[model samples]
Target: MCWKTLLCCSLWLLLLKSNENLAFKIPSIDFEMLHELGFEVSIPDEPGMQRVFYMLQIDDNCPALMDYITESNNGSWISRQKTSLQNNDKLQISVLVQYNDEIYEKSETRVIINARLLTTRDGRSQSITYPNGEGECHAYLSPQKQAKRCKPAQSIVSSSRQTCQGELLFEDNFSEAQLNRSTWKHDIRQRMYHVEEELVAFDDAPRNSYVKEGYLHIVPIVASEVVEGSFKLGDRCTAVESPEQECNIAQGSFYSIKPPVFSAQIHTRDSFSFKYGKIVVRAKLPKGDWLFPYVMLQPVSTYAETHYAKQLRVAYARGNSHLQSNQQEDISGSHLYGGMVVWPHGRAMQYLKDRLSKAHYGDSFHNYTMIWQRDKITLMVDEEIYGELYEGLSFFNEKCFIIFGVTVGGFLNFDDSVLAKDVKPYLNREPRAALSFWQQRDTWAPTWGKHSSMIIDYVRVYAE
Candidate 1:
C-alpha cells in the first residue's frame, strides 16, 4: 500500500462511518411522565397562515399491531413526525413499536405529536347558573303520572295587593252572572257557516257566551238538523277569499251529548292580553276519548286575525303538510295549523285522555299554569313545566286573555265508542259515529265544540 492508496482507503472508511450514522435510528420523545402527559398546542409558527411539518423514524418488532394500538402504546405503525411542530427546535419523538423495518426483532421508537389543541377541560367544567328569579313563576305539566315535584298554584291576588297595593288591575270569581265589568270584555264574532256559497244559520250556536265556574266557555255549533253535517266554519275576516276554508276543529262528537246541544269558547282578543306575566288555573279537564282541551296563547298585537288558510299555506310551503292529516297516531293534531303560532308565544293543546295516561281530564283536578316572560313561555300542568314556546322571538308586549273550553273532534277523531270512554264522567252516552264518519273524513274541515261543555274551577293572572 502506497501513500495514495492509504489516503483513498481512509476517505472511504470515513464516508462509511457517516452513512452508518444517517441510517434509520429509533426516535426518543418526552411524554412528560404519566402525570404530565396532557398535550398543549398553538397555531404552528404561522399564526394567520397555514403550515406543515414532518417526522422521521424507524419501525420496530412486536406481535400484530392491534394489542399495542392504544393511547400509551403505538405498537408496529409508529407516528414519525408532524409537519409544523414548534415548541423546541429538536423533534422529541415518542412511540412504541414491536418490529423494525420488518427485519429487526427489537422495539423501535417513533415521533408522536398532537394534531390540534388538547383541551384538558373536555367536558370537565361545571355549568354556570345565572340566578334569574325576577322574571316569572314557572311550572311543568306532563302526561306521566301526576308529578311529585311541583310548585302549587296559589292566590296571587293577595300577593298582588301587597305588591301593587290593591288597585285591582284584573280580578274574577265564578259566582257573578257575567264577567267582571271592570277587567274588560271580548266579543268573539260568530264564525260564518256556509253551504256551497249560500249563507246559512248554524242555529245550534249561541251568541254572546259567558264564563261560569271561573272558566270562559263558548258553545259553537250549527243548529238546523239538515245543515248539521253540511255546514263549514270559515274566518270572518277572510271569508270572501276563502269561502269554503275549514277551521282546525276535527270532526267528531264535541261532548258525548247528542244534537240540539251547546259548546263554549270565550277569548280576550279585544279586551286584554299580557306581555310578561303569570296565568294560573285550577280545574279538572274534560277527557272524552276524542276530546281536545287546549290553552292557546298568541301574540296579541301580531296575529289577532290569523286565519287557518294562511297558517296551512305557510305550514305547507314550509314542507309540513302532514299537519293536514288527522291520523289517529298523532293525538295532539297540533302539527295542524291550529297549534302552530307565531311563537315567542305558542299554545299547548293535547288529546285529553292521551295526556294523563288512563286518567281522563276530569278524573282529578290539576293546577295548570303558564309563565310568559320576555321571549319565553313555560307551560305547567299541576305545577311542573311540561311544554314551552321558543319560537316567534317576540316578547309579550300587550295583555291577552285566557280561553278555556271543551271541544269535540280533536286528534283522536275515533268512533264514538272511544270518545265515550274519554269524557265518560261528563257526557251522557256515546255519540253516533256512523253519522259523523263522512263528516270527519274531510281533512280540510275541522269542527270544535259541536256539543260540549268546558267547565272551569278558577282562572287567575299575576304580574311581578
Candidate 2:
C-alpha cells in the first residue's frame, strides 16, 4: 500500500510538470463559417489550489471589424471567434490560463479567412478581400462541414431606392453671409394692441437680424434711440377702437419705454407664399422670462377674414352672441397666440403650450413642422405629432405666408397679477416675485445677454 501511494504521487507531479511545458495547438477554422466557432484548450485539473482563470487575446493585426468572446469551466477554456469576411483577412489568436497565481500561455495561432460577398434584398452590402496571394489557401467549408473551394462571384446586386416625405418646394438653410433679401422682408414696425404690449421696436438693423455659420440669428437688444416716425397700429386694434383712438394715429415709431428693446421680424409675405404644403422650421427658442418666440402662417388676403365676418353676422342673427364674442376674440389675427395658425379659423392654431415640458426649447435646436394638406394640418415637434386640424375650414384653403420672430415682455410675460395666479405655485406665491428676479440682474444686462436669442437653422417647404 505504501508503494502504491508513492507511485500515485509521482504520476501526479509528472502530469503537472508536463502541463507546464505543454504548448497551445492551433485549431482548424473554416473561412465560410457564418457564426461563432469554438476553439478550446484542455488542461489537467488538480485537487487543492486557488481559483483558476482563463483569458483569450487577439493580436493587433486582426481586422478592426471583427469581434470575439471567451469562457472557461473546470479544466477547459474556449474562445468563440466570428467574422463575416468579404475580404481575405488574417487573425492571430493567443490563449492564457492562470492557476495558483501561475500563468500558462499557449502558442499563438494564425487564422486565414477568405473573402466573400453576400447580397440581400436590402440595399446594404460589404466586401472583404486579400491584397495579394501572400496567405495560404484554406479550404472553404459549408455549414454541413463539407470542404469546398470558394469561387469569387461577380459584383453584388441590390434593389432598393430612397424615398422622401414630400417634394421640397422651398428650402433656406441660411448658408449665405447675409439674409436672402429675395425671399424675405424685414417687417419693421411696433405692435401696440396686444394683451401684453411688445416692448421692442422692430427694425431692419443687422445687429438684430443676421446670418452666421449657416444659422439665422434674430436677436433683441436695448434700443439706443427712439425711432423717429409715426405708423399705423395693427389692423385688429384699428377695427375695434374708435376712429379718434384707433387706426393711423400719429405716435412715435419708437417703443413706449425709455431705452426700450429692439428686435427683428422677417416674413415671406411678398417674396413667397403657399396655399398647402409641409412647413418645417428648425430653430432654437429664446430662454429669458417673458420671452415669446413665434413661427407663424398667416393669410395673404382678406378672403378668409371676409368669410368669417359673414359667418359671425349669421351667428349673431341666430342669437349666438356669446359665440360671436368668443369667435371675434379667437380670430383676432393675433400672431402672438400661436406658433402656427390657419387664421380666422382660430381653432386650427397650434399654441405649443404643451410642448414646454417635453424639452427646454432654448437649450437645443428642434424641428417644428406644420403639414397643411387639403384635408388636414398636422403640427410636429422633432417628428412627433403634437397637434392636428382636419379639413372643412374654408380659411386654410387660401394662400398663407410665413413669419418668424422673438418678442419680449409681451402678454406671455407674467406681470404681478398673472404671476400670482399662475406661477405662484412654482415661486413663493409672491405676485411681483417673477419681475423681481429680473430686477436683480445688473442693469438688466444678463436678461438680454443670457436668455434673449432665437436661432433658426433652416426653413423648408414641401409639397405633395
C-alpha TM-scores of all predictions: 0.39, 0.46
Q: lDDT of each model, Cα atoms only? A: 0.32, 0.44
| RMSD (Å) per prediction | 24.4, 19.3
- Report the C-alpha displacement of residue 147, candidate 1, in angstroms: 36
Error of 2 at 108 (Å): 44
Q: Write the per-residue lDDT of candidate 2 for residues 316-344, one digit (tens) a residue.
A: 00001111122232211111112232334
Task: Summarize candidate 1's per-residue lDDT along 326-373 as a digit string, tens digits.
Answer: 334432322221223332224322211112233334445566655555
lDDT agreement of model 2 with the native: 0.44
TM-score of 1: 0.39
Q: How many clashes does the backbone of model 2 have?
A: 5
